[model samples]
Target: MKTAASSVISDNDNTPAQSIPRSPRLLETLLANLDGVVYRCRDDAQWTVEFVSEGCLQLTGYLPEELLLNQRISFLELIHPDDRQMVRAHVDDCVRLRRRFDVEYRIVHVEGAIRWVWGRGVGIYNADGEVEALEGFMQDVTERKEAAQALQEAERRYRSIFENAIEGVFQTTPDGTYIAVNPALARIYGYRSPEDLIVSLRDIRHQLYVEPERRSEFMRLMEEHGSVSNFESRVYRRDGDIIWISENARAVYGDAGTLVFYEGTVEAITERKLYEAEMRHQATHDALTGLPNRNMLHDHLQRAIQSARQKGGLTAVAFVDLDQFKYINDSLGHQVGDELLKTVAQRLMSCVRDSDMVARQGGDEFVLVLQNQTEGDVGIAEVMQRILAAVSRPWQAGDREFHITSSIGVSRYPTDGKDVETLLKNADSAMYKAKEQGRNNFQFFAPWMDTQVSNRLEMLISLRRALDQQEFKLFYQPKLSLKDGRIIGAEALIRWESPEQGMVAPDRFIPFAEEAGLIVPIGEWVLRTACRQNKAWQDAGLPPIPVAVNLSPRQMNQALPEFVANVLADSGLSASWLELEITENVVMKDAEKTVATLNTLKRLGLQISVDDFGTGYSSLSYLRRFPVDALKIDKSFVRDIARDADSAAIVKAVISLAHILNLRVIAEGVEDEEQHAFLRENGCDEVQGYYFGKPMTVDDFTDRLRKEAVQAAP
Candidate 1:
């Protein structure tokens, strides 16, 4: 029953038993009530136990007598195999040095389960200091040790996730300096390692984000709401490539409730942003021409109207329709038609200022919105003129030269309807009016145009019906030799003899025919009829004078030469007995192609002349290049030759120029003796006018040819 303190005092042999402060029985009671074992053992290899307290049963699962004196088991054998050597070495070194020792190790219990223990002991030395015993107190510490191990395992898992996660993770101080960053974050920033990113990017506000204010915004959001989700921004990578990123972050606070740092996850979003932008563009723009489509046009027009209303300025909307586009589409195939539309889109874009917008309303229709026009209709009219000219310019479709024109109708803001739909509708009505007046022109929207649209549509229908009903005729105008005053040739002109409308002039219906694409068939009729009449005259033994047929601008195509040859053959008229008359503008358009066509016609043994010679803006160089046998002076110049000095000079100059080019000159519209004398004195080779004879019927022309043949009898 002796306590270790009392036993040590009694065994000291130096007044210990008498001087002890407490009784051995009392100390032994305290030791028995302790939560651990109090033990004494000899400093031997087995650590032989000399005495052990009753608590030994609880600490090591052994009774005091079982471990005392090594009766059943030595205390050293109780130590776990893994910790035995470390325990022995530490205890022996502390005992040899006469110092206290503290150690922790695992030990085996009576039931075979492992338990962690902490032991504290010191050497009990002999008076001579040569021998000693070891005394120690041992306690089970399994619960605390296991708790520490569990905490360590949780920390390991957290670090693993931080290192290997796909999204970037970071901890940054309030001043924008990185406190800690995972490897994933380093890779996201284009850095070799987290250390590299931390060292290289000192200022996240300026160095990392493309806009420095983004960092400020992020901080503001965190300050206001304590966290941010889907905070999007543009940031710079280490290599300086800009990319989009979205951050989800929280402001981390310390125990004192003060902001410590920001912790966040970042995701790259550049690809998603680009995809959205592409989708937006596709929705607003035309697929074929890359111009704004109707959806965007409405949006633009609405904006323009709003702006014009606010500024008290004018906004003009032009609705454009391509003249005779359907005929071109039907005849040339949709591929060529699509190409022509694309070219026209480009031309239309070039005619306007950058402040204006051009949009494809669909098919052959386009809408232009002109904004902030202080000059009102004057400026709009100028732009419309430019558009008309640009659209009418010659373009190629396949191997053929084509001249297409546009009819434009303009509607003004406040004056025209104020809404988008009304403005567009009014402009459309005006465009139909342009077609009625003659295609290839522009008109301003008037209130009356709404009512006239139906009338125009009816006229178009009637014109189409006329062709099918064979209500067209060819009238011949005699071309007299100015040198001899006799009929040498005739010009074939078309006249529509409608039962409903009576006789219609060429000017009234020819433009509509050209616009509706009926010109090709109508022109063929004229050519065939003229050729047959000339052949009949020759067959009747009348003089075999050449008959000239006028060519429409639309008729001047790669197929024209073959078509004319076919007509000549079908009519049984020799090619030599036929002549083709092309206007100056038609020949000047696509000049290279025109020259090739003229040379082809000449090779077919026919005559070609430049009709209406001085009207078009033709280059003299192109004039020299045109392969024609004659130049017919336009009526405008010939009509005023006797009175207007400018007209007279132009007439004389044209004759001289024609002579110099080895081409004959013919003056038409000569209604007076003075005009005839003026042309004849200028060495004109031929003349055609009312003064000689107006355009007459085929029978009348035939009789006139007969009289000429009789007058020339030898």
Candidate 2:
């Protein structure tokens, strides 16, 4: 049954071209009934239609019965105007070559829309082999042609991306030979052309390598991880100068999981590497001195410790501090101070070994790493003492000869500390001990230094919490008239009564507070509290005098005008009743800025007094520029006024200088009648000391005032 059915289908397929029993009329009827137009016409100006099918009416929206055998229109007239030349060329060319005639063109419908029709067949040949008639099939193949065109456009887009992508896309063989590369890849690898690179860079591990191991490393990472990120290395350029490159790559695998080649993008990273190095250096070193700053010091110390441990050698960690650097910094200008620091750094460098490290711990502090000290602590100590001597040598900054001294603290490996932080800290503590023993000296690590560290730590903790807990109090010392011996005003001093330790004195804690940055807030509290207390006194009918308050250098030099204004507002006191007592150190350190700041304060009606006048570097020329109302001759000059001739001379000169500047001179620390006699003889204006009565509480002060009032009436 299957064989009989298949034979019937085969006969049915060939039945269309088989001989027909129909006559010519039946053939004409067959042509009119066909689903497409079948035509033959002369190729001329009017190639009129010879036959038309019923389908022609449906195709061109025209009645085919009206236009048969050139009754109304020619087939050439239906051809689109724009495609006429192309169709004519194909037909004429085929005739000229005696080739088969096949062509496609657009034809306009009666309604004026264009449709594409494809024709195929061959040119009829004459007896002499000259073309006579053309026979072909016309079909609507517009859908198939559009689909082929879309495929071509899509291929062109992908080809464009593959050619011009910025990333160097490449493919290579398993043995690392280049197979193909884009134009971008060739430029990235510093080659003239992709073809040239492929030919010249046969062995990527050899000819293209700046570092031979780069290829090996690349292969190793690819094998292990199947991909690599930021795979960076140097490769030789065509001119042999090395350039940096980083690859983000993956391994392409073939069937059976065998590695085929590496495929990735190459990016030139030479400028990026150089920029990174520059940024790293900037982060780790001081810009002014070009020295390794505190950021780099810890790592260097750690590395030094590691090296010392390997050789079983001692690591000598020395903390270097320039003694009296502040004195010089305040005495000379900052320019000279900076030059001195540079000189000191040079001296420190000269005294140490080439392998050793020196780092600036900020300010005048330096940390030295002396690695591989063979003779133990003694050898390190000797080197440190030599460093002290070397740094202490007199050096000139411009025309002025200056002398400097350094304190060295030594901490050794496996003894004082086993790590960076501990070693650095111990060295710092030991350096302070050297400073205490008098600077320009060296000291080794001792157990007693821990006591100092613990005290400092405890003090810092107490200072932070002291304000919150209200453990800080102000003590008011009266400044009496040297002529009448009467209390005119008082100076407010801070005393800390800690729950842990009782009464931390100003002398003991003020320096620590300044160092630890607690003074800024603490100083503010003192100023406000002093002002408030003076206001209370005035409200309670006690005579109001300018309440003098000690100002630390940190507080005086930084934003003093703003702080003073804020304090006065908070305390409900006028500036005329408040005085800011600034030490000469504050005045001398940047005289121009100090003068400007003081003038601002003075404009607000606050009085300025120079405290400890003779102890600091002050110039008589610049002294006149300060907005000072009074000068407090330092206690040093007053202590030996009756005996020491130099002390007497300085005191007399200060008193005379103060009077000449119209600033009243106040002598501090007048402990006896003899000291008073001497100061009175020198024409001093104010005296404040134990002889006048020590710092007293408010109630005691009021009682003293009442008694003095009664005594005066009598």
Off by over 4 Å in 2: 1-39, 52-80, 104-118, 124-133, 139-148, 151-163, 220-229, 250-262, 303-311, 327-343, 393-396, 450-466, 469-714
Reference-based lDDT, each prediction: 0.87, 0.79
Instruction: Write one digit per residue (lDDT tens) for candidate 2, span 1-714.
Output: 234544555567766533434355556687777656666655455655555566677666667755555676667677788888788788778867877678888888888887878876566677998655555556766677788779999889867876889877788786879988888878977789999889888888887768889888988898899988998888887778888888898898889888877888788889778745644564466433557877578878888888778878888888999988999889885557767887888888888889898888777898888888888877887788789788878898778787788888888887999999888888888988998888889888887777577788887887889978888888888899878888888888789888877877887788789889999889888888888888887887766788898887787554788878888998899889998899876887788888888888899898889997765556667788888899998775687677666568667877876898999999998888888999998799999999888987767876787677667773
lDDT of 1 by residue, 1-714 (tens): 666777777887687566666676677888999988899999888999999999999877888999988999999999999999999999888878888999999999999999999999998887899657888999889999999999999999999999999899999999999988999888888999999999999999999999999988998898899999999999999999999989999998999999999999998889767744543454466545768877679889999999888888899999999998999989887557878988999999999889899999878999999988888889889999999999999998768899999999899998999999999989988888898888899999999876555765676788888889988888899999988888789999888899889999988787667877988888888898899888898999997888999999999988999998898888899998898999876986699998888888888999999887765545667888888899998886776677667568667767877898999998888888999899888899999999989889988888888888888899
At residue 639, give the lDDT of candidate 2.
72
Q: How many backbone clashes does candidate 2 have?
A: 0
Give the clashing pairs for model 1: none
